[model samples]
Target: MKIKVNQESCIGCGACAAIAEDLFELNDDGLSQAKVAEVPEEKKEQATEAMEGCPTGAIVSE
Candidate 1:
């Protein structure tokens, strides 16, 4: 599975970071973006939680 973030819909909320700091980050633009770091299978669950935690509904999965 892969996760994608809609940068425009992100509101700079740190929920994703809170849930999975290794998977997502707040860039210099102050919007949430996925980290370049590879996401392991074990981390996918937290990543999904983080995606769901976004109040702006900015996350998509494929």
Candidate 2:
């Protein structure tokens, strides 16, 4: 699975990064960006959790 962050929709919240440090992080602009273009099989669950936890729904499966 691939995950992508919609910068325009992100509110600079750190929920995604806090939930899955290995999969997401806050960039210089304070927007959350996916650390990996493709999700590892083992991390899909964690990534999904992060996506769900995002208040702005900026994270999406690609």
After superposition, the stretches of candidate 1 with alpha carbons farther than 4 Å from their true spots are 36-38
Q: Candidate 2: RMSD over Cα atoms?
A: 0.6
TM-scores, all models, native as reference: 0.87, 0.96
lDDT of 1 at 32: 81
| Model 1 lDDT tens row, 1-62 | 67777988988978898888888888899888888445688998897798778898898777
Scanning candidate 2 in windows of ten residues, the lowest lDDT window is 12-21
Q: What is the C-alpha lDDT of each candidate?
A: 0.82, 0.93
Highest TM-score among the candidates is held by which one?
2
Worst 10 residues of 1 by lDDT: 31-40
lDDT for 2 (candidate 2) = 98
